[model samples]
Target: MLDFNRRLFLGLAAGGAAAARFGAARAAELRPHEKELYEAAKKEGQLTWYTGQYQAEPSEAIGRGFTTRFPGVEVNVVRSTSQVAFQRLSQDMRAGVAQCDVFSSTDHSHLAFLKQNERLMPYKPQNAAGLIKAAQQAADPDGYFQVTYLGLFLMGRRSDQVSEADAPKSWKELLDPKWRGKVAVGHPGYSGAITSWCLAMRKLYGWDYFKALEKNQPQIGRSSADPVTMLNAGERQIGAAIPSATTLLSISRGNPITMIYPTDGTLMVPAPSGALKNGPHPNAAKLFMEYMTSPAYYEATRPFFSESLRPEVPPPPGSRPLDEVTMITADPDELERDGQEVKELWRDTFGV
Candidate 1:
């Protein structure tokens, strides 16, 4: 009877111990990075990322990369035209919704507006100090905005119709009658990067130059990514003002396409990222910003045709060496003052 009682007690104790071990193992299933992300995200419960163009592809890549390193965290992305993203952010802000976490946009137009309205909070990413000098210098004084990436070229389908040597090397070359109606343009009103390109042309050549190009009758696209696809399909043999990624990705896929980094100059527009002032997931947004901006991680994950804000992150393959290209500089003040007027002019001229 004593032995039976002792055996029963030992069995019950071992079962309890087994249950405790299983619970502890289950708790550890959440990766450390995931635990960090989850702890930060629980305050907000969700994060909404609004970004420009191919941002979805890279953003998803980053999200997968993040999840691999840190399980248990999920990231949701809302990709659209920069104009659309800004409008949504603006609307949410005005309505007191406080829905989104991270706002990833190209150019300083939205950044200027966010600052002007005090809609952005000053929260630098954890890795901000390790950014390249250019990237660091481009960040807003109070950390309201930070430069993300710089793109430098336009692309086209490499049909026998255009020779690599004869590609447009200056803005003036694009207006040649032979290329008229053959070019694809993203509506400047909706694409901040394209708008920046137009603004850069205005600064570099003259306002009259844009007026002349308008007369060339370029076919405007809805999303910036559309032109790249159109060029890939050979529906439009030439892509106007496409950034490096569109063309390079197409070329790598065996699409007969080529990119032109205008010899006269290409604009280096910095896409700025920030957290909404009253975002739903402030902590999660900050964590994401840290993830996206980390020099080490960014270098490891950068697309083959893009430039990372980290000097340590090498320029993608087939890109013009950073030193060789003369990139037009943008003035945030000027962009803020004239973005609407310029966009209006673009609308009137292009009918987009």
Candidate 2:
């Protein structure tokens, strides 16, 4: 059996001869044992990935990294909101078209639906054993889908512009008069992170929290990612609810931002990955699943500001480990049941 530990994963950072075939470039290497899978994937030469975990930019970057690591395998990334991606997959399946090789979504409910229908391919990778135990436990035990990415809705602020003394330390602080015009947030309807955050908030603080926030006139963006850009540009001093990954990624780029994990607790959502059962590129899809779970994939796509799946590769600076942070997760069943109702309430209260 081949080990997919940090050492082996790092070694495969530059692929073997198969990867070198593309150019004089440093190829993405596969394990000596994986040569067979590599050859098989080479035959398929392509895959289409549908994802709602990241926006187009980082999504494409991850795809590019995948192709770089495994030469001759081209990846076409189709990215949109979680619900939108799910709808696309449903349409393709219903139409009898195999348009996606893999599907990733921020909405946990989607995984349950796909798994129940037996639409997801079940081939657990050896690399999966290296994932964090908490996240691993959250994976579909039957192997229909696995937790691939994670993000949290935490407060963020322009550290340079917002003094530490004045910055909000908790979610309720954002409602203070001092933060009236300085706050920004993601729309619950469009962002799975925000949807989870809103749902969790309603459970913890009730709908009144959102109603009170409305009086502060918070600027609402489409997704949790938007507040990162908004805060970076100084359009808003504080992102009331943005992806912790987005904030950390920005700070890494030297943005004057600081992730503020609320005293109350943050809303962390774990996104899942699944290979489509009838995907056109089965071999590539399986291999890609291995890559997604491997440390090599983490090395290839560090821009993700991810909570490391494996303890070997730690999360970026200035963020608490998922286990260390105070987190509130929305129930997948609850989201499936009440997501629409929360979104409706959001629009009515915020008028966004």
Candidate 3:
């Protein structure tokens, strides 16, 4: 809420510089398994990562950071929305082509489905132990997939257009007639975060919640990040399901946007990543998995406002601690069971 002052900005800069130094130092000395994987991965030359978690810029920056840390191995980043990435991976499987070495999606149910189909390789990362307890608990018990990215799905408003006093305080307030034509959201069929959000809303208030929201005529986009884009461009006054990291980055860049932790509960989005069983670069995929969970990975993503999985690495500036907010999350079993139904209902309710 414009509280990100010069002092905080300077502190963030200093923190980033220190993280970078630490990453460089860590890269100079690799663990035994890492060194062995590096030798095998170097022979493979590269790994293809199908990522549906972060934006294109941040995803590519992670790829570059991985390449910088482990020379001679390249990372090919293919970024898309969660559903789209899943569809592409499904197509590749049907065609018998091993294009994606690693799969990272915001929807945990996707990993569940893949594991059920025996599409994911079962390999636990050594760095997984370094993750926070909550993150560790989110991982698959059998090690088929692990939570690699954590974010919050909350509300946001264009500060210049909507005063803080007038903004909606809870998810139910979004359906008020006064906010008609002013709200922006993402389609559950296209975004995994939105799918979880829709599921949570349904569980709490029933499908009538969205039925009422439809009366407001909210603008819907493909990605959950799109609502922030709409608010930043002054095209929308409110965002019903916005990613906190994206909004914080926009605010830091002087965008007239502010985050609102809904009084009901903020949605906790835990994006999971796994290696494909039939991937072309098996060893490289394993190495990339290790890199994604390491401190160096958090360092590359801290500037983009990505939440830290490791307790040693503090969260980025202008972000709320997870403990301070009431969080709503759907488990993989629930997500796997209801994901398709949510998508179908979303299209029926919104006619999109």
Best by the TM-score measure: 3
Which residue pairs show collisions in model 3?
A: none
What is the TM-score of each predicted model, taking all chains together?
Answer: 0.84, 0.86, 0.92
Distance from true position, residue 56, model 1, in Å?
A: 2.8
Which pairs of residues collide in model 1? 158-256
Q: Candidate 3 on 1-352: residue-level lDDT in tens?
A: 1111233223333444444344422333777888999999999999999988999989999999999989999999999999999999999999998899999999989999999999999989998886656667778999999989976889999888889999999999999999999999998888899998888888889999999999999999999999998887888899988888888999999999989999888887778999999999999999999988887888799889987776556677887655466677665667889999989998998999
Q: Which residue window of length 10 is worst by lDDT in model 1?
A: 1-10
Count of backbone clashes, every candidate in sequence: 1, 6, 0
Off-target runs (Cα >4 Å) in candidate 2 are: 1-33, 321-324
Candidate order by lDDT, highest to lowest?
3, 2, 1
By TM-score, rank the candidates, best first.
Answer: 3, 2, 1
Tens digits of per-residue lDDT, candidate 2, 1-352, equal: 1111233223222222222243222234567645777799999999999998987777888888888778899999998878778889999988989989999989887878888888899878767876656556778888888888866678988888988888889887887887788898888777777888888888877899898888888888887788889998889999977877777778878899988888888776778899989999999998888888877666555556655555556455566644455666787778778888998999899887
lDDT of 1 by residue, 178-210 (tens): 777787878777888777777777777777776
